[model samples]
Structure formats: C-alpha cells, structure tokens
Target: MSTEIELPPGDQSLLLVDDDKAFLTRLERAMQKRGFSVRSADTVADGLAAVEADPPAYAVVDLRLEDGNGLDIVSALHSRRPDARAVVLTGYGNIATAVTAVKLGAVDYLSKPADADDVINALLATGEAPPAPPDNPMSADRVRWEHIQRVYELCERNVSETARRLNMHRRTLQRILAKRAPR
Candidate 1:
C-alpha cells in the first residue's frame, strides 16, 4: 500500500536516465503520473543524444550507467539548457561524486531507493529552502552491498577483476555480489 504524490500539471519536459531498466521504467511512470512529460534512456549515450536534440526542463539521472557516467548527461544538458534542474541518483553515494554532480549542474544529489515524491520535489522545488533529509538512510550493510555492486560494475561485471580490485577472495566476492541488496 502506497500513497501517490499529487503534483500540479505542467508542460515542462523531463528526462530520466538509469542503466537499470526496471528502475528507469518505474521512475518514468511515476514522473508521468505527477504530470511531467517524461522521456527515458537506459544509457549515458542515449541520454546525451536526447539532451542534444531537446534539453528537458528537468532531469533525474543515475550516477553510473552501463556505458558511462551520468554526469556526462548533466554536462550536455547544461550546455544545451543551463537552467535545467537535474538531480543525480546513486546507490554508491559519496561526497566527492555529490560535489562533482552539483558542479556539473545537478541541483540535487539523492541516494538510491528515493521515491517518486522525493524525486518530484527535487525537480520542481523553488530555490528557497532545501528538502528535508531522508528519514531512513541506508544501513551500513546496505552501503557495503552498494559499494560492492558499484565495484563490480566498474570492473565490467568481471568477478575475478572485481574481487582483485576489492582485495577479497574470489569466491567471497562472488557470494557477496550474488545476494540481493539489503534494506
């Protein structure tokens, strides 16, 4: 059981970019439900192409994609439409990347598992005040899981390489990576 946020209707266009197909689809539907004219891409290149063709009024981009980092999308969006309000989402959040996201023109940085309401608020809020901090932040175990997944992705999903990079036994890394992310 979930309650939906009611956002006022608008003609503004929005772009959603994430490598995870299910997450991207869910975000697209949620954004559309909230009255945004939403467009989605699952790769950085496609997202950049969309931005080049027509910059959106708002954007929600993942920090990492299969082909490249989502920051590239933000940069392209910036060049095409400097006023576009972009938010960067990541499962592996860190201060350095958050700062880089903002520097690249993202208005907000959100960790993964952000709900539709959070994303909408970030996209549409006027610059008066910041949104409230997340009530339930990721736990330490969740953070560790996210980090392992990120390392695996960065290694092109190569188990041995990721294990070597993470300095863990290959079997241990495999077992850890195989489990679903913790809540």
Candidate 2:
C-alpha cells in the first residue's frame, strides 16, 4: 500500500543522506532557502530511521557514505516511502553504479561538486522523463560541470567545503574539475 501526501506546492520536505556534518548543514540551509523542509542524516541507518519515522517527499542521496553505500539508503527509501522521489549524487561517477542507481529507482544521477540547484532540479523537474541512455553519459555533463565550477569558485576553491558538499576529497575534486576546465 502507498501513503498519500499533500503534494508540496512550491518546495517539499527532503531527506539528505551523507556523512559530512558541515556539508549537510549547508545543504539543509540551501534546501530551506528554496522553501524545502529538510531532514538530515549522516548514515544509511539514520536515513532509514527518518523515513520510517517521518517520511519526506524527496531524497537527495550521496552514492557513497562513510559507513556504507548510499544505494542501501535509496532502497530503504523506496521500500518505505515508495512515493518519495530520489536523486543520487556521487563523486566517483561510474557507469555500473549509475545504471544500478536508476535500476534501484533513482530519478537521476549526478557527479560530485554538484550545486544545490542542479540537485533541486533533478528532484523537482516533473516533466518529460529523460531518455533511457544506454549509459547516462556526460550529456548533462557540460551543464553539470559548469554548475559545479561556479560553486567551487564561490567557495573560493576551499576543497574541504566543496568536497564536503560534493561528497568528495580535496585531491579528487581538483583532479576531476581540472580535466573539465577549459584549456
């Protein structure tokens, strides 16, 4: 059986699953800015608890958490709150996990250093389902890359803050974004 929700008119309540406290706080504030009510957790267990206790209308999950794979968290969300939408964000973007995320019922997948807006867009974009790509390539690559860059710039290239929000590391983010930067 499915639970009914009063569709959020402007912004919806959201569940944020990640292991970084500072980043989680920043994200929660950003979501609140967009009129969202955010309930946060630093591990899969905490996420499951929040969902079981007071389910949110949506979830913004990182593919990797300090304790375990965020996929497990997504699965729990689906099983407990089937109506809730999910968007998986990752720092180690790869094809296998990306496919698995969709298979597990995520609405979209994203790379790290992601902006709150792109995350929100993936959460709230309610029309024209994206084509089933054999592999979700870098089609959203340029736009996503650009968005992340601006965020990095805004954070003054502070790798810790950027990585925390993007769920990545100082080195990894530097390396990846370097590849995307213009020559």
Candidate 3:
C-alpha cells in the first residue's frame, strides 16, 4: 500500500538541498507528489545559486554538503526571504549544531531518514507550537557511530585523517565505520 502526502493548498515552491544524489532525486519527486513545486540542488554552490535566483517559500537542507555546510544555505535563504521556512536534516545530531541551525533560521532540525511527511509537517508548522518530540530517540551508541561517519566523510574517507582528528587508532575507527549503523 502507498500513502499520499497532502500539503497545504498553494503554489509555493520548495528547495531541497543535499549532497547525496540519490536522496536528492528521490526527495524531489516525493515533494512534488505532495503538491510542492520542488527545486533541488546536490551541492552547497548549487543550493545557494538556486536561492539567489529564486528564493523558495520553504527549504529542506542537508546539514553537510559537498562544498559547504547546509547552514550556509539556510542563512542565505533567511537573508533573501526572511519569511521562508527552512528545516535542517543531518545524520549526525548534536546539541551544539542544532542550536546553531535554529539561530541560522532553520525552523527545525531533523535527523536523517525524515520522510516526505515529516518534512512537510515541519515546513507547514505555524510556529505557535513546537512539534512533539520523537517517540524513539537515537541511542548513545547510534549517535557515536553517526558522528564517526560524519567525520569520516569530512575527511574525504581517509581513514588516517579521520582517526587522527578523532584521536583514535586507525584500525578502531575503520572497524567502527565498517559495521552497519547501530539501531
């Protein structure tokens, strides 16, 4: 069975920015089906350019992009269109980053794997009430593993550099990265 997402009635365009090509493509289609006119960018440069050319009414930005942080995109969106609503999605969640995202004008910070429904709800929020917290938050181990993966990617998948930055043995970091993400 398939469920259809119903977005609020309007012709508002949404911008989706993520470095993962597959994810960006899939999300663009999903958002379109939900009734949004979607614009997608797979890099920070492209995202910023899209925002400059045409600021979207809403935006879903990945926290990490190939060229720069997703927060940069949010900041640009906010500057161009202060009323625009934005959400930040990240695989690696932490308090500091979450606060930073909000201060940069993201309406909400969501962990990755957020479905189309979740993104819509976040964007359409009235800002009068905070959304309910997740029923199941990430376990500490899961958070750790996600952080390691984020660092790994930031280092361009160089085990030595990732290990050095994390201050851990290269083999240990490698083993952790090799395993599937913790539940």
The models' CA-based lDDT, in order, is 0.86, 0.77, 0.87
List clashing residue pairs in candidate 2.
none
lDDT of 2 by residue, 155-178 (tens): 788867887888877888888777
Per-residue alpha-carbon lDDT of candidate 3 for residues 34-125, written as tens digits (9 for 90 to 100)? 78898998999999999999999999999988688999999999999998999999987899999999999999998887777677778887
Ranking by lDDT: 3, 1, 2
Which numbered prediction scores highest in TM-score against the true structure?
1
- In Å, residue 41's CA in model 1 sits off its true spot by 1.4
Count residue pairs with overlapping backbones in model 2. Answer: 0
Model 1 TM: 0.79
Give the range of the ten consecutive residues with the poorest summed lDDT in model 1.
Answer: 1-10
**Per-residue alpha-carbon lDDT of model 1 for 58-130, expressed as tens digits?**
9999997879899999989988999899999998788999999999999999888788878877877778997
TM-score of each: 0.79, 0.65, 0.78
RMSD of each: 2.8, 9.4, 2.9
lDDT of 1 at 178: 76
- Arranged by TM-score, best first: 1, 3, 2
Greater lDDT among 2 and 3 belongs to 3
Cα-based lDDT at residue 29, candidate 2: 89
Candidate 3 clashing pairs?
A: none
